[model samples]
Target chain A: MSKSQLNLTRIVLQDLWHNKWVMLLALLVVLNAIAVVYTSHEGRKYTSQWDQLLQERDRLDIEWRNLLLEEQSRSEHSRITRIATKELNMNRPLPKNEIVVRVP
Target chain B: MSKQAKRKQKPQLIQWRLYVVVGFVCLMFTSLIGRAAYIQIIEPEKLRHESDMRTLRTTSREVQRGLITDRNGEMLAVSVPVKAVYADPKVVHDKNGFADMRRWQALADVLHEPKEDILKRVQSNPRKRFTYLKRQVTPAVADYIKQLKLPGVYLKPESRRYYPTGEISAQLVGITNIDDKGIEGIENTYDDWLTGTPSKQKVRKSRDGHVVERLDMVQEGESPNDLVLSIDQRIQQLAYRELKKATEANQATSGSIVVLDVHTGEVLAMANTPSYNPNSRENLQGFRMRNRALTDSYEPGSTIKPFVVAAALEAGTIKVDDIIKTNPGRMRIGGKIVRDGRNYGDLSLSGILVHSSNVGMTKIALSMPVQELLGAYQTMGLGNYSGINLEGESAGLIHDRRRWSEFERATLSFGYGLMATPLQLARMYSILGNKGVLYPVSILKLKQEPEGTQVLSPEVAQSVMEMLVGVTEKGGTALKAHIEGYPVAGKTGTARKAVAGGYGEDYVALFAGVAPVHNPKLAIAVVVNEPKGDRYYGGDIAAPVFAAVMSGALQMLNVEPISKREKVRLAANSRSVE
Candidate 1:
């Protein structure tokens, strides 16, 4: 190689060595920006998952209330009595027919 | 000069200009850094809060109201989640005419409303933001409407109160309004305990109006406290059935029955006939809505005779076997004449109660101090609020000492001057059956034994109870009140209904009693208002109802029969049949 070309290469290498800290800082800044973007994206994904879970909980709560209401309506005493006396042909025993037995 | 010299001079000048430019650029960079530092460090929180305010929405969540259950955990009242459909009229109006018409038609079809009506409602106030399309729609209907995706249409979660037992428990469990607010009965009394507090939360929404994040709870919602009442569903149903039967059979105006726990002073059942169905408010009339057992008071006729007799005994002026002459069936007291249906010539104190002689009660009452009778009545919870916390409860009128005249005092002996609700009469009988210990009555379930005051000596109460038992025997006034295996002890009251000026032809038949006289567990009172036929007497009308209800209630409660006479009679009848 010619001396001028070699001299030019040496000057370029020296300039790079002198500004190595600035290059490292620029690389770090780019890495940090990528990390920020990735974490924010993950956060949004998890938040949506949490929202889905909340909605599921609300839906289940409503279902539970409905079931309780249904159970109450079905098990009402008056309804049972009506069914027993009407549909089942049941009748209360006469007082004279009821016998007392003591259990020991 | 040579060309090389010119180049060297230009390079030096260019270097000096470059230094000035670099200095200006650095000054600008420093200014920007300072401004950025000021924003990031000094006022970061304020700016962040301002940004959050714009994007972070606060929403209120409705908490479910608590359930009301009977003593055995049978649900009486419950709150179910429903949806309320609302519309933003302005949004509907902002659309073009065709689109708006299409939206209205779709919404109307979904809501089961007329399309023209919906359109008119929307256009009536174009500037109004919100209007209710429908309230308390089922979740399924709400889901269908939501799928339509009509602009400005929304479904908001709400709750509705439901009564499972319907009219049987209407007057006792009470009713709630459309907003899930308690308006009557136990619902009104325990509203605060049954109501739930709403919660506010912060949420982040996406562009499509989906909640993407739940930030934090601004305020925590409190789950409502469930109410455990003292009423037994089985007994309540029995009382309701019997009261309805008797009221219809007698063609009476209305009736009320109350069954109380003698030991706990807990009202097991309170049923009022002509009760309205709380679920539907369409045809509910004022008369049907009255909780007569707690709200209305009538002059309780012979029901008060026992109290006076007990007072006479307590004052030591009369003994259990002391004979008083009820000769000729009538006597004049002050200005009023008290009479019995027949001349029960002479009677022991127990005989007086058995015959329900008005003259006998008046003779015993006059022998005692007036204050003694009043004090006894007051101690038995007459003329006072029962502390049940029911709305519009009547403190039945018992005139004070200063207002007491000779005539008032005489009529008070026969249960004419003083008045009492059926519940109060039941409580009085409960006090007697509980060995004279007056327990404070409660409509709510008691977790522990209630405190009671000793109003009558146990001996005096025992004697009074014995006399009451005679009222249900073969020749007693309430022979129809007899149950097959249980010895019922009670009094029959046939009070002539007082009109505006004088007594009317109508009568209020009342029977107040306790069953299984050996170990009384229940105290029941039945009042039939204005019975039509020859069965207008308390013995004929109210006593039979008491017999039917008490028989079933005792069997349901598993109360063992302790009557020796009933056992002997049953054995004899069986032997004769064999």
Candidate 2:
């Protein structure tokens, strides 16, 4: 075609070749920015999960304490004695009635 | 060429309009740049703070108070998560919370309050921000209230301390206030150790209540510490039951019983009569709440006779075979006559203890130096703190005076001039049972046995312990204290209550002893005050309780019975001698 157009195209190619490193760096920076967004999103998701887990731990702890209290109440000494005497017809044997067995 | 010629004719007008338009556009751009610079440089914090107010939140984790268990890991005191129901009055009015009257009635029923009272508290102050509807309701009740879904009604978490053993250990484990603060007993002593601090953190939250980013921690959480006491629940229950029965049967005013471990000096059981239930907040009398084992002091009566004998033996003034001549039933000491029920004539040391003769004890004390006797008492841990380190403990009074009187010395020998708590008496007995090694008293469970101080020579202590065994044998003072399968070495004391300048009609019945004499395991003391009936002797009331508790405790701890084997061996040795 025209010699002037050919000269302009060659000059544009030389400029692009000279600035190739800068272009690559710009692309990497864009990719890093996108990566930052993705990681932050993932971090938030995990944090919420951890928060839920902490709540679950607290709930279980409360339940465990309640169970301990319940067990203690059920095994109370006075209640056991009452049950043993009234319901089961049991009593502590007298000292004379207890037989002494020696172990060799 | 033709267009250029035409343009040249209107060039002046075009030039004027272009200059005006350019100036106006430049002015608009300059103003925008100036505003941006002012905002960024001068007033950024205002908008930043506003954004933070919406997004930043400080969240805290709930921390419960610690647990208190016995030596065997049985729970004595526990904290259960509860809820404090409150209301935002202003919000209630705005949300028309009272529109549904049935919901309010249901809440009142659950809270055990009248509907009008609950509504009035909310309606009384419309502008008020907050008010408590109820404090420390159970989680089940809190859940039920949540189901009602009354606007402005809210429930926040709290904790409540509960004692499983109730009145049996009320005076020892103590009770906490509604705000979860320890107010009395062991709970008060270790309040700081039993409390926990909640953790706090700052986080950025999104619009949908999701934690978007974690920020710096405001406070690191500390898990609460737990406490393990040395008290055995089995022994404590047994002691309380027996003490309650004895006091009720005798119609006594009050009583206290203390059982100590002879080896470790651990207080296995300390029970007081007229104890109130810690669970119920009704009728909590001051006298009833007193741990009389450590707090109340009284003249120890004949119980101190054994220690006096031990002191005389230690001081080399009295020998194991010394026969003190007690002729008449009474002897005049500085115009005051100390008398026994019967004259124990020309008796050995063991006979004096068996008869519990006041005249016999007086003669022994008068022979020894005053300081020598007092020093022996001090070494045996008399009139001093029991080393339990509990609150409201009295050191009991011992007159450290230069001036002396003969009658005072005589009275001190029989445990009248000085005073002591029941726990001190038990400790002295424990020393006797432990072969003169005085261990520091412990209320908390110990992982290892602590070093003990040699308070008395092992020979003197053993000889004294053997002599005390006669008091529980046939025709001795404390016949009731004798166990069927175990030999008990104990003394009986019936101290007449002192009034203004003289004595009162009341008597303090007491018995202190150690059981299974071959290998002493437990030392116990019982004190009953002011029986209404005629039978106020320590042998009758207090000795029976001591026997019942000690026998049961030995069985529970699996201490072997020494009766059959010892008797058979003694018979065989006697036969060979014959």
Candidate with top lDDT is 2
lDDT of 1 by residue, B220-285 (tens): 988799999999999999899999999999999999999999999999999999988888868878
Clashes of each: 0, 0
Model 1: per-residue Cα lDDT over A13-96, one tens digit each:
899889999988999999999999999878877887877787789789888777877987887777888999999999887555
Q: What is the DockQ of each candidate?
A: 0.37, 0.52
Alpha-carbon runs more than 4 Å astray in model 1: A1-54, A101-103, B1-55, B97-100, B205-216, B401-408, B563-578
Candidate number achieving the greatest DockQ relative to the actual structure: 2
Q: Which digits, one per residue and each the tens of the lDDT, describe model 2 over residues A1-104?
A: 57545676778889888999988899999999999999999999999888888889989988988898899999987788889999999997655567668899
TM-scores of chain A across candidates: 0.63, 0.66
lDDT for B122 in candidate 1 is 66
What lDDT is reached at residue B33 by model 2? 86
Q: All candidates' lDDT scores?
A: 0.85, 0.89
Per-residue CA lDDT of model 2 for B481-515, tens digit only, reads 99877778899999999899899999999999998
- Each model's RMSD to truth, in Å? 6.0, 4.7
Model 1: residue B176 alpha-carbon error in angstroms:
2.1
